[model samples]
Target: MRERAVSGHPDRPGRTPGVTLPSVTERKGTTNESGVRAERQGTAGRLPALAHESPATAFGDYRAAFHSARLPMALLDGDGLIIAANPAFGELLGTDPGRLTSAAAADLADLGSDPRLWTAYREVLCGRSDRLRCTRRLKHPAGQTLWVEVGVEPLPGGERFLLTVADSSDRHDLLARVRHLQMHDPVTRLPNRALFFERLSSALEAASFEPSGTGRIGLCYLDLDGFKAVNDTLGHRVGDRLLSAVAQRLSRCAERTGGRGGDASRGHLVARLGGDEFALLVENSAGTDQVAELAQCALDALQQPFDLAGQRLSVSASIGVVERTAAGTTATGLMQAADTTLYWAKEDGKARWTLFDPERNAHRMTRQALSSTLRPAVDRGEFTLEYQPLVGLGNGRAEGVEALVRWRHPQFGTLAPNRFIALAEENGSIVELGRWVLEAACRQARAWQLERPAARPLFVSVNVAVRQVWDSDLVADVAGILAATELPPELLQLELTESAVMGSAGRPLQALQALSDMGVRIAIDDFGTGYSNLAYLSRLPVSVLKLDGTFVSGFRSQEHPNPADETIVEALVSLAHRLGLTVTAECVESAEQAARLRRIGCDTGQGWLYARPLPPERITALLDADGRTDDF
Candidate 1:
């Protein structure tokens, strides 16, 4: 191949293309109309773009055109020599462009000191490819490194190559930001679900190859207890502030306990699973006890309420901790088990910890599997209704029976509400369950009215979960149920707990009012179980207040010493009466308790002693006897 000399200037040009003029040219004396070659090296102000000029005046216009290019450029010869260099190139390499001539482009690049540069150059010179681009940092004279991306193209005639360089420091920074956003949660800046799984999977692989005796991975799934209470009490804006603060605490704990400070085997990853659920993935755990200890640390850390947006808000977590040698079980199975155990923690009591047990996990799995069938169970007629009689406090006469929901499982025989009501609430199947209870109880009340139509105008009290009240068409469902059973609104009462209406803002309050307006009596069931603000009661359209079983049961228990129970009950009774509210006392087991309740001014009562919740037939027989039973 032939080498072409890059001389576009002609009028004052001292050299011709491929002339190979002698190094010093005693003839030209290193000076001409082109301008005196300085005793020391110097370059014109800017690098020019020669290829864009017309060849006719190319030689005359080269110098002007060369001053406009932004990128540093240089021309390289076949012998790896820098044939010509621009001012920008001189500034980039920290050298005078004139002195750079006859120096190899590799020498000017400063990468010539590295072995890799030689290998890349060798390949480029061999015509393996015409272009080369790479990102590499080179030492500069300023005691700093300059990051650059270079593009090299084979110039026509095969002798010279054009090199263009750009500084990519800013671009590199943007790339880092892009990666972080992809791997972290936008709101909390914690590792997202994607990154957590990646780290977990890697840890698992390492655990498989390592000896079993070494250690294992620990997973702790923590869900914020009563987070919904906070959201319902405050608002989502405050809830978000609380969540961010929680993320900070969790991240700090994860960093402190993940592993050895300087080792990869001890890394921990913490992530938010959306909403109020957060998870921690721990590596290199010694045993179950160690995992439990870590869980305790987490719980203690959350004991201090988070101070956010000027509010001292308390946050507690129910954590399900699981530690396995990563030998027997897989990650998915382990997480599922941990999650199952977490529910047990919440079920046992909020703000607690529970370790995964296979037996408990199996039971929870069965329960979860059964929950999906509950909605369909309603349609299939697998439900039954039982009524417990509500007797008058003074007369001991059965007033009306409260409706209780029971599910008959083909396999489990019969399931109680406590068994599946939580599940139904979680899966939103409670809407159907509530409606069924309504219809069943209303019909039973109608039947009782048929036998004794004037017997105190018997009313059926049906318990409605807060979820149902918030989810279903409450007024419509109750109205339809009563109309269908030919029962009046007064004959079918809806029992709502105090907490259900305490912070009753938004649609829930409106729903309650709508049901109340339909002439259906609304009662606050389990009044004192939830620490409700009693002032809200005066504003509610409630007709009855059922003293919670706990308050009434404490009246006679020797273990508890509280005369306030009776005082509070009497005061509530007085308040109920003053506010035109009837009082229904629950858990009336003994004749003494019933008599005491009546003495305290209770209008109605229900318990095992008042003819336990019986089948429809038992209820009918009682009504037929017309309160003439020998037991009564």
Candidate 2:
């Protein structure tokens, strides 16, 4: 068939009026070297062709030249009428190509009133640009809408234009995949830290600026206690699986509270902050009591043991919570405050929840500064260990020396254990510091043995912080320090508080037993201050009980009056002797108190009366003054 040449429009007066050749669609990922494929018969046609059939006929050759033209194509008249289109257009829109008629520019692609697309098209139509590109939503009759990138351009004289639309289906799919990976944790597929913060920021803003709302947010920062043990004792694979299970359980916590409150927009979010630390963000929350309820909910959810790879693992968390308006607040402050509050939870004892208090936060800030400075202080030689001799009441000779920590701050002068031990434990520096103290004290004991060669070596007792035992490798660490110092374990004593020993159930007790079995002695320090289970005291392998300083401090009277206090001390001495444990009275500040303790048959005593705690050098001098040399 002889094709009529494509025509130009009246807008260009001097141009030839006949039809011009049909245009070819650009093909991607195709070898168009061959004259088009038979299947791509008529997908392209000249934009200004006024005769539809001729344009359609010419398009077949254009389509043959570009076989991979996947996007739909169309031609529009000066009035924006659908003049001619290819079969691909109908297939893409799920409509008949022949049935589409030209209408207003807005009517054709449903540009409607959205100026983003309309303005771009008008600019191209007025000959301001040769081409226009835009991303748009095309609503389908089947109720499915697609994201598309449409390119449109004007022909000469502005009589017609070419429109090409690419199905952004693949790009959209790829974006969805990328977004999922970006927002979710690959291990658990739970929303990660970035996404959680994004949501939290938005929630804070909404609560802050949204009118007529109370603007409250509840946050629960939870750290899984004993989680490190699972990783160290088992393996990381098991730990990873446990974290995944934890995420699932936490998700259930968020969902349990997410209910429609007559309006559908408010709820809570749960996210994993990092290893072993997770959080729940509740938006527009109630006050502290309600937040506490949420915490209780989470605790209840975590109460059940996790089944990870054929092993049943148990863990509990310490939660710190705060719920209030986001007014004048920042994301960083919120998280830092939450973390600080969590430290308090752990400090007060784990497996519990504590509400955030500004006063508590101030204390935390001070402690944090102290904790950071502790490591450097050791190198600066700021710490000194003081040994208060424990004298055997029967022989008037030293039986042991209790090593206590003291710091000589350049500005603050001498600061005792009360000032730094808790801070050190919080920051985990206590493990190393405690080891250093142990080694130093044991070496001092060896020195004391050398000086008093004729006398038996006095046992050296060192205090152990509970965190050092829980978080660090207690058994191996103690054993390593003993081996390193070449100090006999029999001469070292590990002193712990009564409360620390009470709740070990089975595990901590097993650990303590391990240390004791290796020949080290165990003593319950500050014995009567805590709820001392005397029933279990005998069962413990402890060798000594130092009565709390409070009991002895109150035992004295202004005159020779408190015989009742002396009688009570006598009863304790009898009770301890019956249990095969030596009882030592602490803070025996006066000769009168020392005489009373001795008269009561107390086995051994530690007090200022026996000579205040001194440095290792002083302790050595004292041993030498006793005038014996390695003669034991």
Candidate 3:
């Protein structure tokens, strides 16, 4: 086909007045290496043309294609001013195609809104970058927001650039819906655990970067008390309704408390953390007072009865409140503190809120550290025995000694038995510890007996935990320790707390009987403090009763004496004597207390009045001093 030659505009330079362009089919079949190479070079490649087409006809075809294309397209000059915009581009902005010409391309699509995007856009227009692509949110002239992806590419000539936009609102909306479902709890319609943590982390990060705010964060972690009972009694469907109602109340509480100090914009985030637990996060918290107010509001909200699925139910909640400066706080650390505080609230009694206490938490952490290291401490031989003199009140002489166990901890220094004895029992380490005490005390008693061949040997009394009787072979252990130490069974006294020895049966009963039959003396320490079952004492092989300190504390007063204490002691002594059991008074701090105890027919006394607990060498010195003179 013969094509007409077209004339170019007289105003535009670098164009021939009459030029003929090639046909599209002829350009495609041309074996020109430069054309193929240009096509491979990318968007900046030279434009292919028809062999016999005029410049006007080619330009008209190009304009037709550009206007009819679905993608929004625009042509920008070197100055970033839109020289031409296709119909599709004008429709995207809800404007006329003619009106868009000569406008700044950056201003039309908000390309220069962000500094980074603006820099890249300038780079592409200046031929420094091949292309620039970014997603932008634009406000259309029609009062609608459009999310579009804008692409800027260098034109075939270095002096111009081609800008195209693709509408991404549908894809963005779909993604938003999917994210909303994933981040929310279906039942309560609140943010779930994943979303809560994400927001908390983001808030913390923002606080770190922006130091202008309060720089403090707060959280209220709460659990619904007796919610499990509700789920068990009623169906899970009813329980879910109750949870939704609780969520609504909590949301209202957060809303009410958020308006304080004009912080409604940074309101608390109420989230359901699975099951009956929920969390309220406060970013840029003013102080602990704000957090506390939120917690109290939540408590008050949940206190009202919830009518769920025709079931009227009442439930209380326990909350842990934690507020601290965000500078040193982490999501994990904050959550842990909140969890511990919640436990404290439960322990302090439900239906209340407790703030995080550092001192109490430190003590608990120390206790945990001690518990974890206890069994190993025993193997390391960190325990030692100290002996307190047990004197015969009638003779005024040290008849025996009560063996007290102390832990020479490496980190915590010397710790008394009360600090770790109960911990040992709870972790089942008491059996091992009790065995060590038994063996050590027995060996010491034998050493004392061997040291003093002529004088009366001091019997060693060792404390026994009730767990040892049930958890270990107490009878066999006692016999083995005596045989190993070569200590006479008669010289070893085993002391058990009154409560531990009461209601003895099963293994404990059998162990006590076998030990007594083996000639080991059995003594009940802290006699009157426990069951005080004077009747059951006869059935057991109890050889001695150490009066509790409370009964003996009455003897501390001289000017105003407690006659009732003395009378009670006298009666108990008379009854014990008839049962062939000797009575020992504990905590006899003064001579008057000792004299009164002696006058009441008490056979022995153990207290600071005689001597505080001493090491082995000190006990040996006391024995030597007593042996040389009768002044003891």
Candidate 4:
């Protein structure tokens, strides 16, 4: 067999007709014009042009190419012996070329023990395949595994085979790093939302296929209470450090609570869902009991002060726990429920955990629906006001009417002000709603006044939320509504809660005084229900005090009335009278209650005893009865 000096194609006797391959010397540099070495190192030794036709020269070229191919190369005989091996293969195996030659390829890489690799090798050696390529692990004496792409090409005679190996360790390492980043949070090195969702979805899917009551999932969604305030006050650097410390504690919680009893997938997975919110996904949950215990563990873990930049900062967490069989549940549904329950924990007070309650959640959803509908309802005229008469206790005459706002919710029938007012205030819709109520009350009052020329004009009192006073142009709104409705200032009373008036010493105080100067009376509604700050009560320009209904409830048992409540009411009445302020008692449901209020010197009473809050037409009808004195 002649080994020709093949300068072009390795399989051909001479250079390809007309096509030229770069000579060994020319191709020594990289594939690109860059000075960097080519990924494949060119054959080490090159034959001179004068020796191109000799058989021995061809053998030298072939031998040089075999040793110089940068990718590890080897040749094997029919018996699976390593007949020849390149320096690269020796370097890859950490052995000398001479040692590699006598050593079987399988022995060098421990591939013979793997049945799959041995089968593929036997198939190639028996001429059943021309070539085979696959990834295999190389066992090093240092107890390390090296990944390599191994390719076997059968020789023309089938008695010999050539093997080429390319180390894939670096590529595999790069891929592993990429995968880690994708699943983990960089700051805390915790599983991120993406990875958490993937796990949750997989668990749920597996649960769906299993029998009922087999697989269950639990999730504890946690939010750091007062974390935003800390971030704003302490700067983001400290906040970040605090978050890292919190993450460490939460991870410890996961490890401690996830006892060894469940399947491979059944474990605690604590992940950061972003910001100060983190979640723990529990697989094969034993029930709410286990979930609750885990949540408590997390709460206890976070109770310790975080040491950040030498500052020990106290922190608390609110956790929402949801546990259910994975059969019909979903990742999105679980997360949503957990979030809602977390809000319940916050509302119930921080540093605790709350389990999901369907009934409570339904009520909250209804409230949220109402809050969202408020602004549109206002614009759509879905709100109406009913007036409850404030009757004079001495003469049984209608003294004033408290204007109460009601929502004519299309789905839920008519709702009282208490149902949605707080939500409105929270979402800043109260300002507009307040303005609307003021104008409606004033218009109704003016209409009643005009209808009864012989009767005294009844003053209309409209409840003003604290937010309305602070966030809205209350003074200007009152003035404009008064002028628009032609209602006299004295006939319009603005009722603020006791807390609202007690805290009004700055701009709010100035606004109240300005309204009072305009002759629109300012009254403290629901008095004695709040802080009941008597010291500052006399300093305000308030003209009326509507005692909260809690005070009037004591008057029910006249035989043995609650003396403390009676005394409190009496003192409130005396104080208001001393300040020249009118006193009105709320919730005088019984005649005896009204009479007791009268005896206590309460100038006015408002409750079911006088009348439930009536629509404007009903009140107008009452105003026409006997010059309005017999209406009550």
Among all candidates shown, the one with the greatest lDDT = 3
Q: Give candidate 3 misplaced runs (Cα > 4 Å).
A: 1-65, 75-83, 101-104, 115-133, 152-162, 259-265, 627-632
Candidate 4 per-residue lDDT, tens place, 1-632, comes to 32212111122222111111122233343243321123223322222112234545644657777778888887765545455678898788776665554344555544455566666666676676677787766665456778888888876545557888888999988987898899888887788888888888987887767675358889999999999988899999899888888888888888888632111144788888899999888877889999999899999999988878888899999999999878779788898999999999999988899999999989988988998888999999999999888888988878788899999999999999889999999999999899999999999999988888787778999999888878888999999999999899999999998888896778899999999999989899889888888887778989999899988999997787898988988988998898899999989899899888899899998888778888888887777663243445
Mind sharing the TM-score for model 3? 0.85
Judged by TM-score, which candidate is best? 3
Which ranges of candidate 2 are over 4 A from the true structure? 1-70, 73-91, 95-136, 151-164, 205-214, 231-241, 259-267, 287-290, 307-312, 370-632
lDDT of 1 at 531: 63
Each prediction's Cα lDDT score?
Answer: 0.73, 0.72, 0.82, 0.79
Worst 10 residues of 1 by lDDT: 13-22
For residues 146-221, write the lDDT of model 2, one tens digit per residue.
7777778875445567777677977987997898788777776666788778878888888767877767778899
- Candidate 3 has which clashing residue pairs, if any? 22-50, 22-51, 23-50, 23-51
| Backbone collision tally, model 4 | 0
lDDT comparing candidate 3 with the true structure:
0.82
Worst ten in a row by lDDT for model 4? 12-21
Residue range 1-632, candidate 1, lDDT tens digits: 43222222212322211112113222224442323233112422223223445445533755544444667787654445555667776677676666566554554454344456555654565566677777766556665566778777776545447776676767877886897788777777777777777777877888878775355878888899889998998998998888888887876676666542212234666787778888887777778887787678778888888888889998899999998877666778877888888988999998998998878777867797789798999999998988888888877777777888888998888888888988998898888878887888888788778877755565788999889877777878877788888998877788887878787877788888888888888888888888668888888778888889987886665456468888889898998899899999999887777777888889988888767777888877777665422253
Stronger candidate by TM-score (1 vs 3): 3
Q: Which candidate model has the greater TM-score, 2 or 4?
A: 4
lDDT of 3 at 151: 92
lDDT of 3 by residue, 185-212 (tens): 9998888999889888888988989868
> TM-score for each prediction?
0.53, 0.49, 0.85, 0.69
